[model samples]
Target: MTDHNTAEWWRQAAVYQIYPRSFADANGDGIGDIPGIVSRADYLAELGIDAVWLSPFYPSALADGGYDVADYRDVDPRLGTLEDFDRMVAALHARGIRVVVDIVPNHTSDQHAWFQEALAAGRGSAARDRYIFREGTGPDGSLPPSDWVSTFGGAAWERVADGQWYFHHFAVEQPDLNWSNPEVREDFLTTLRFWSDRGVDGFRIDVAHMLTKDFPDPLPSRAELDAMPQDGAHPLLDRDDVHEVYAEWRAVFNSYDPPRTAVAEAWVRTPERRAKYASAESLGQAFNFDLLEADFDAEAFRHIIADNLAQAAATGSSTTWVLSNHDVTRHATRYGLPPLNGRAEKQGAAWVRAGGPEDQLDRETGLRRARAATMLLLGLPGSTYLYQGEELGLHEVADIAADERQDPAFFRGGEYDGLGRDGCRVPLPWSASGESFGFGAGRSHLPQPAWFADAAVEVQAADPSSTLSLYRRALGLRRRLQTDEGLEWVDTGRSDVLRFRRPNGWEVITNFGTSEHEIGEEANRIVLGELRDGRLPGENTVWLALRA
Candidate 1:
């Protein structure tokens, strides 16, 4: 457990992300709820994470997988109630684990009371002014207001029956809020205070870079956007004005006794731009996703690490490292598959939809590389964010039937583009023999593949060589080995291997190539991987203690 009194505890914390719906189900409803999280509090504590970052458990109509929040202050009835949320927070705190909840500030569900009122209040009404509403382009106003497109696909604007078009960066069910509206800004401040008062340790701001937009009278077409310089400010993303919103949010966060912390889910292009969200006046941390998008190559990982370190130093903030999340394919599966040829964002959706050819994936090699990659991730300086089930080496459930797909991206022409994220959101397998593999008494909302039986928590728990055991040992060792805020690169004289030394005299060496590498260090203990004939095996990571 981390010392809460320590300043910026999150800087060194190991945060675990729990996707609420698939984490665990306590009520046998097939959907994970707050009580389910409470039930797993001991498990989380045993996993040795400092905090659990819960994805949106708020009231929703299942639009955009709860990103389209209908209400910010309460839990969905299907998931749990306010009392249950309180209980969940208390339970984790009792185990010395912090609670970080997700906050979707960019947009709100159309089902929200405010949006409902906006629809009824007619065009140009005060309620309508709370969201982005514009007139159509054509004479009869048949076309949309702009040529902008949603991140999920299709036109960003949705025309209402009243002949006015409202913008949604995502699905039509999620309407973008107008940050220029004082009411919209103040209401979000209230929402922050509501959760802060309930004792949440921090927040993970959803689409943090997208709160403010700078749409011209006639928005540039998609082709023009493609031709624009990479450094140019996006019309709807990472605009300069978004920082002002975070400034206000920072004030609210600072008003609390412990001063709640936040991490921005900003997807800006450069490390410098991303660091702005982690400046002193903004959110204290921002996810460095370059690692998630990189190949398993050693040079790629080295470059990303150096860049992230420089960015963090510039902002005086810690880097947040994550390999897999609910939005992408599990690293285990990705490592097993062939190179994506620059289609990393798709996560092999097209290949998976085609039944995942055996020749395309080397499962054993993938798991080995995934383990090595995690070792590299944990050994790095700064905070580490672990997605749920990565500890058990879970793979993407790619063969989910098309008829059962629920991700809004799948329905909005994203399937053809191989953009659906459902494969990574399958429920976890706890037991090997249960009807739903211990997810719940009922069937899971997304179908679980049969291979999950081999990866069940029970089975992994009993196997010492399993990925679960590796994670436990690695996490336990990390708590002791992580003594400095930076690392010194150790030259291995080989391009295929990476070696870095922590200030405390602990060295992390990983062999990324097929050839075995010699262990040149005289260490007191081998913390993680093993050595064959005093040589580190290919695709293996070893941690060594070189000092007292």
Candidate 2:
């Protein structure tokens, strides 16, 4: 066991995301519940993850995959009872791991009480101020509002059957709250307190940077939504104004005893300014858009890491990053494939899918890729996060046919990328039997990937070379970082490599590019994982503890 160091909790923390519905099934209800997660808390404890960030478990209409929240304080019957959530939290906390929940504040399910009251009372009612509404003609002459499109595929402003316009930034059913309103702001703050009071440690704020849109005014104009969000792209969010809203939220977080965190999805247009939203003014952390760039070359990653450090040094505020989230395809699908059977990887060789026989392994162990990506992911100076199955070296294939796909992003924006999210938000692998894999005795919400049986937790737990073991060691090493100690990024900036130094003389070097690179020798003891004579093969990664 590592020494206790709560000050640097985030630095050494390894967060695991659980998409509540697909983790496991304690009861035979066809849907995963809080009891399922509680059942798996021991599994998480054994895996050595420091926290489990459960996706929203609040009541919802199921539109937009539960993002449309209908009730803020109650647990969805589909998931389980409030009693179940309490038990899950207790179990996780008892194991020394924190629990973070996804908080959707930008909007609420139209079925929520506030919206229901607004609809019943119509315009000029007290509840109408809770949401944003503008006066104008709908896209077609027959509707009641202006031309903003719903994230679900139609106009952002929807006409109540009563000939009144209601606002919905994402889906028509998810009418946005007016953060510009002090009353709405207080209500959301109270909601955060509601959960934090119950024991949730932090929140991965959903559509975070989105809570405040063109307040008093309507959402982005039709022309703005159609344009690409690049360096000079239109400012859909992260305006100089809304930083106050974030400050308000952070202040509330500060009120908690343990100081629970809040991370935002601030996909601002320019890289330089996007880095600024998290200057610790309004939020503890905001998503770094650099990782989402199409050209994820070695030079690109090197530049991104350097730029992130520059921002931290200049602002005195930390930075955060995530390689893959539920919104995008897995790293294996987007960047590179893992190696087959744990063999040393070679360059100029095309990688294939990771599945065949129990022993055949995916053409690649994906370990090298997983190790490479995670090494860089953790080595970065500030807080780091990972999606649910990432620890199991889980790689999902794009098999959801056109008909099976059900992403609100697809229906809302044709200009948006193909339905890429569902593939990423897949079921987690837990067992090895051909029929069960432990998620259940038989069927699941989605088909288990071909490699799941081999990669299943049951199987990996027994193999020392398994990806799960690597993460356990890696995360356990992270837990050793002392909060009072400072972290410095060593500029060994080679195109083929990414390296950084953490507190306690720990360093990790990842080979981001195809070519092999020579990493400088470790000054301290080469403890934990290792690098031989400062050399890392293509896609190979090494982490070491130094004595300096």
The best candidate by lDDT is 1
Per-prediction TM-score: 0.95, 0.85
Per-residue lDDT over 1-548 for candidate 2, one digit per residue giving the tens place of the 0 to 100 score: 23434633654356787888778877755567799898988888876777888888899987777888999888999788988889989999999888888988888999999999988887777888888765565564355455656655666777776667777777778888888788888887898889899898888778766666553344445675556353332334555656677787788888877777766677665656665565666665666656644234567777787777676566555666676666665655544432232453321111221111233334363446666677666655666777777777776546666676566765555224445366666677787874547886566666566767888888888888877877777776666642332456566657566666766566776776666676554524544455556566777677766454
- Which candidate leads the pack in TM-score? 1
List where candidate 2 sits over 4 angstroms from the true fold. Answer: 1-8, 138-144, 215-221, 224-236, 294-296, 337-367, 411-415, 434-436, 481-494, 513-525, 528-535
- State how far residue 302 of model 2 sits from its true place (Å): 1.5
Give the C-alpha miss distance for residue 229 in model 2, angstroms: 11
lDDT of model 1 at position 199 = 95
User: Least lDDT summed over 10 consecutive residues: which range in candidate 1?
Assistant: 348-357
For candidate 1, the C-alpha RMSD (Å) to the true structure equals 2.3
Clashes of each: 0, 23
